[model samples]
Target: MSEQAKENPILEVESVHVAYGRVQAVRDVSFSVPEGGLIALVGANGAGKSSVLAAVSGLVRPGSGRIRLEGKDITRWPAHKRVGAGLVLVPEGRQILGTLTVAENLRLGAHRRRRQAAPESEMYELFPVLAERRALPASALSGGEQQMLAIARAMIARPRVVLLDEPSMGLAPKMVDEVFAVIERIRASGVTVVLVEQNARRALRAADTGHVLETGAIAHSGPAAHLLKDPRVVKAYLGVE
Candidate 1:
């Protein structure tokens, strides 16, 4: 939505590296996320897409380089601190509290730290299924329903940017469609999004920009439309004929 000239990035990852003991997971990777834009990191498992997202969310500390939010370095900040600073991560799996009712889980997500969270009424409007089962225990929901609850939980916190890792993992085909629809709505709401998904085609289709990762490094980077149409990308990642 930003007219090219004045577009400024809200988050920047500069030469970031992440390691797990002897294994290097991310190798000097860097990218910028513009405010209200959606970027996707797509690759096979072990390609380090999740690791990069973890580093950004402060769920895992990068071995080196800088992570900035609104141009302020936050590489050393803790996870909760980053959340308080308007960053939230809906991690790899939908991590809803199984015992709590859907409404209770939503209320908990809007902790005192939220600068401005969506009202429960608005969340119900955004996720009608959640509203339909508002009083049901989280465990009663299907995998797709749980994913919706997970996303709603994050959105209720009103983060400036959200990091979503593998949101479509383990979802049914119809559910995957619904999840993507919600993602588009999230982007339209002006919240910057960083998505890591294994379904390359769908992810690229939903993104403003797409980055293909291989062996912990970016193998391709371009506008989403370009990446989707790239012959090599189509053959190697998109799984289309």
Candidate 2:
């Protein structure tokens, strides 16, 4: 990452608030993600992590404040436009089209910019299992494989930043490890990552920074390593598991 981009965050959410009808989902939440760095938003359900991502991804409009990507205001851009501008979100569920062939599903991901997207062969290289089952229906894959497919689909969009919501949510322990390893590879390849995960310890462990949200506000924010050992964080979220 360039020093300038890191100094001035590639993606910035400034005092953003989100509401659904009369109930507020996010309240004056703000954070900046450095280019190519990974940040995790960790909190219990209903704490508003997903709402924050939704606002940024343009799935839902923020009621107030602003969102910027690479220093350009994109608060009102539509979701497809955001995707076209290199902001991609892999939603909570592995939302791959079950009936489509694996290759077909991957092809759909590059709909925005085919030239910039990695070749199908390259995606196959990243997820060998996907290649092995390319001709098969997506439903034929295991949960872990489906999750890999979901990520591969997003990557094919040539994203500059990826917003991951609960990537490890439903998998077995071993599968969860595999998914996180993939996440590491993605960040290593220079894509900024905003991860909202339920597994606080694992998320914090993998992130450059960690934000602990409570009741729609950030209760704690710091370097991931510091958050890992924080007494209050450990007691409230990490637990003794």
Candidate 3:
């Protein structure tokens, strides 16, 4: 990684609060993802983990505080504009186009300016299975492949930071491993990842840092290694016996 990249964070959420109607979803959440690290957000459902991701991706507006990309305030930016600013979200449910061919879906991911031959080659490198199944309709692929394609499509946009929500949800054990491997590779390639996972133990293991959310607020935040060894974290989230 470049020295400059290591010196600056790609995304920063500072004291953000978000609400839906009368219910507050995120309360004063603050965290930073460095340019090339996997940062995990772990919590039970309705703990505001997804809320934070939505707020970062512009799907949900923060009622207070600021979001910065490369140190620029982007709290008020819309979703499409956030993508243009090199922030992308691979939303939950692997929202692939079921009727579209794998190649077609990937093509849709690129902006008009970035629809070059090089992106296809890059994606093929990141996901060889995608190259093999490029002609198949997205619906025909296995669950893991669909998730891989969803991630590869996001990467095709050349985003600096990618927000992944519940990436391991509803997948088989082997498939979960495959998905986490892909996440590690993305971070190795210098893309900052803000990952939310219901599988708290696995999430903390895969991330460089982990944050625990409870009732719309961050209850704890620290290095993943340290958090893994923490008794409270293990007892509460990891189900320690």
Candidate 4:
């Protein structure tokens, strides 16, 4: 990471508003994901968490305000173009290609994108299970394995920032834990992550900074550890005793 990349955020959404026709989904929302760390957005259902991801990755256009990547405004950028610019999204569902084998999916992720000069031995190193199942058709894998493949496919693209939407959804408790462990490893490997999750407890635990969304706006944000300990956060989301 350059000095600018280190000091400057990888992605910044400033005072953005997005709507579906006239039904506003996000209103004047703003947040920043620092380069090379995990920043999570946590909220109740329909709090506009997914909309935020859509706006950032250019799936939805913002009515007002700007989206910046590395200090450059990219609100006008298109989705596929954003992928070339090093922004990628692992959407809510594990959208793996069922007919493709694991290795094929990974190779396709790197399609039209430059491979990392130094191989990501770390990825296979991190998830030894993926290597073991590399030849299986995606549909043959378990739910947890499919989720892992989705994340691994994204990683192979070598994106500078990734937007992850509801990664823990539909996962059993054990699978959820395993998926989160992979997310932590992704952050550790120098990729900035923007995580949108309804599982506030685990999201806050894994994030460096956390944003709490309510009804399409950023209701609260701060350091993860501090927010994790906040009384209101504990009561509403953490279920502290």
Candidate 5:
């Protein structure tokens, strides 16, 4: 590990195990994100990608092991507390309130720390279509627009680390490209990102490092560029010849 990594890990998951009743969803999964780095967690459905994000965001408790943010233990923190502490999760499926106007839904994201929220102008700049539809109900937005809104809402909270789950799911190919571009911009803006996606090729391309999870355990972990070219990764996840 580099000295810079040691000095500034924005998030750390150490031997995390997560479960629901008798069923375990994640087993001994571990990774770390350096400040301002983008880490991609890629796997098929039921590989426990979302479970890890849920645990990091405090939406679910780990049965064992520790979760730390900037080196402080946050394993027992509540979801709202985690958000306030600069860890936010943009869950799969743009869960914007259907009845609320786009602006209203976005304001709700800042409920934890209104004073620290990013300005609406910043979000508008990222997704210009959103600015034009700010007054419309969130349900009225197209699939890609709703996804953009979900990302914008998370950004409004000014989180230090964003756990993004399946941002490209259910989008057209063009929309997926657009979303990936926005994700790149998000990383450029200096926020650490942990992206969980089944879109392995795109996710690995966008990330600084990549981890491959299989059946709740980390199967492979390394630099994103190397993973992209790895024969096993390309054959199993990237669908390359």
Candidate 6:
């Protein structure tokens, strides 16, 4: 960890375990994100990457371990409470309302704190295409456009830490590039980011730090640049050259 990171992390996931019914999806996963840092969590399917994000967003309760934000423990905080505390998740599949207009979907994201919500203009600036289709149903937008809306909606909450799950899933190569660019801009704007991505190469390239999850457990972790060059990581996750 760097001197700046040691000062105080923005988000901490400590030995968390998440289970559903008879199945344990995540086992003793732990990682930390420093303020304004971008941390990439990369793994194959069923590696429990999304489960960790769900636990952090309060969508799923951890069977054990702790989650903290800004030095305070938030392990038991409800989803709404966590959102109010500046933790937000832009879930996979761009879960924007299909029937609602683009503007309506963005408004819903800030419904919890309407008075303090970021102005729509800010969202528009980040995603100008959304501005052009404000009155159209969210379903009408292209895959990339809907992804942009999902991110814009989350941004309206003014999150201090954003958990982004599979932001590049099912998009064209060009669209994927656009999404990664936006993520970079988001990080540059000072929001700590925990990105769970299947694109290990891109994720590692973009992240300040990288963590690899295998079968719900952390298999490796270190500086993103180092992970990108690691022989084991490259062969197992980043693809053989």
Instruction: Please name the candidate that would achieve the greatest lDDT relative to the true structure.
Output: 2
Better of 1 and 4 by lDDT: 1
**TM-score of predicted structure 5:** 0.97
- The backbone clash count of each candidate, in order, is 0, 0, 0, 0, 0, 0
Candidate 1's C-alpha runs over 4 A off are 3-7
* Candidates' RMSD to native: 1.3, 1.0, 1.9, 2.2, 1.5, 1.4
Best by TM-score: 2
lDDT of 3 by residue, 13-65 (tens): 99999988999999999988778888899988899998899999999899999
lDDT of each: 0.92, 0.94, 0.89, 0.86, 0.92, 0.93
Let me know the TM-score candidate 1 reaches against the reference structure.
0.96
TM-score per model over all chains: 0.96, 0.98, 0.94, 0.92, 0.97, 0.97
Looking at model 3, the pairs that clash are none
Q: Candidate 5: how large is its RMSD?
A: 1.5
Model 1, 1-241: lDDT tens digits are 7565126789899999999999999998889989998999998899999999999999899999999998889999999999889999999788899999999999988982555877889889999999999999999999999999999999999999999999999999999999999999999998999999999999988998998999999899999999999998998887744
* Model 3 TM-score, 2 decimals: 0.94
Model 5 lDDT per residue over 1-241, tens place:
4578647788999999999998999999989999989999998899999999999999899999899999999999999988988898999997989999999988998887687898888889888999999999999999999999999999999999999999999999999999999999999989899999998988998998999999999999999999999999888899953
lDDT of 1 at 174: 100
Per-residue lDDT over 6-88 for candidate 6, one digit per residue giving the tens place of the 0 to 100 score? 57898999999999988989999988889999999999999999999999999999999999999889999999999998999
Q: State the weakest 10-residue window (summed lDDT) of model 6.
A: 1-10
- Per-residue lDDT tens digits for candidate 4, residues 24-134, read 999999887778978889988999999999999999889999999988899999988888888999998979999999888878777736644124454567677788888
Error of 2 at 83 (Å): 0.5
Candidate 4: stretches off by over 4 Å: 1-7, 115-122
